[model samples]
Target chain A: MEWRAAVRVTLKPGVLDPQGKAVQGALHAQGFRTVSEVRVGKYIQLALTAESRREAEEAVERMCRALLANPVLEQFAIRVWPAEQGEEETP
Target chain B: MEWRAAVRVTLKPGVLDPQGKAVQGALHAQGFRTVSEVRVGKYIQLALTAESRREAEEAVERMCRALLANPVLEQFAIRVWPAEQGEEETP
Candidate 1:
């Protein structure tokens, strides 16, 4: 079966996120006055063949640890499910 | 009240994503031969003050339109919820 996966990689706590801080400042300057903080991360979507949901999840987790995310500075959450016909349009 | 929001930005269908293709090739080379495709996107986390969930959602949508995402080549989904005590640690 083909499975679709999404991995969200975010900076760990206490990490200095200059990109996030710069975005926050930009938002404030643009009149989003209530925005207090912003954090930026990466979202990766994958399509793969797997025998089962569990297998897909494990593969995705391994991908995260190996290449999708940097464990020292980042943490990742993964979501996996069977792929739908038109799901590829949106990722 | 303080609200937490996540914005997921993905490439629009039919858009050329060399980065995605590169990652897919890398993954396949690493022995993940079953992998068919990959897509890359951005995930943004925000902390802000809002009167209600609706307000928070609106602000986030506006942010996506104005700065966080490029509508011509990308689409974005927004998730808003109340801020939890330690939620910032992961985003």
Candidate 2:
């Protein structure tokens, strides 16, 4: 089966997000408030084919650690579309 | 209501991901294959509160354009949780 997944990688909180800071400043200058926090990172959607969910999850995790993310500077998580049958998806 | 959302920002396909390339090179040297591609970027998860779904989407979109994304170099999409109670979520 082929599935679509979205992956996100971000620097840990308190880590310097110079780029994010710069963008935050820009927004503040424009009079936008209610944005109590700002962090920047990449978003990716991939189409994958696998025989089992376990196998698919493993591949995505490796991809994140291997190249999609920089553990030395960031942390990441992957969200497979169509929530798993029994997962709690808080809204 | 407050909800958890994830944001991803990535260079569009074919745009140069120099950092991704460097990491890709390193991974290959380490003998990991099956990774046909690697694109590096940041990922973010947020906790948000809003009066309506429209308000939430607007806030997230503004955040993306204002600080989370570099329009000159990348594109992004917002995925709200619980799939709007009836949205399609392909797993």
TM-scores (chain A) of the candidates: 0.91, 0.81
lDDT of 1 by residue, B25-80 (tens): 98888888888989999999899999999999999999999999999999998878
Tens-digit lDDT track of model 2 for B3-66: 4455666786679888766765765676545334556665555555677667877887887887
> Which residue pairs in model 1 clash with each other?
none
lDDT of 2 at B57: 78
Residue-level lDDT tens digits of model 1 in A1-91: 9898888899988999999999999998899989999999998989999999999999988988888899999999887878875463322
Q: Provide per-model DockQ scores.
A: 0.56, 0.20
Alpha-carbon runs more than 4 Å astray in model 2:
A1-7, A11-25, A41-74, A79-91, B1-4, B47-49, B81-91
Task: Provide the DockQ value for model 2.
Answer: 0.20
**Each prediction's TM-score versus the true structure:** 0.93, 0.61
- What's the distance in Å from true for residue B22, model 1? 0.9
Q: List the residue pairs that clash in candidate 2.
A: A9-B43, A41-B42, A41-B43, A42-B9, A42-B42, A43-B8, A43-B9
Cα RMSD, each candidate: 2.6, 6.6
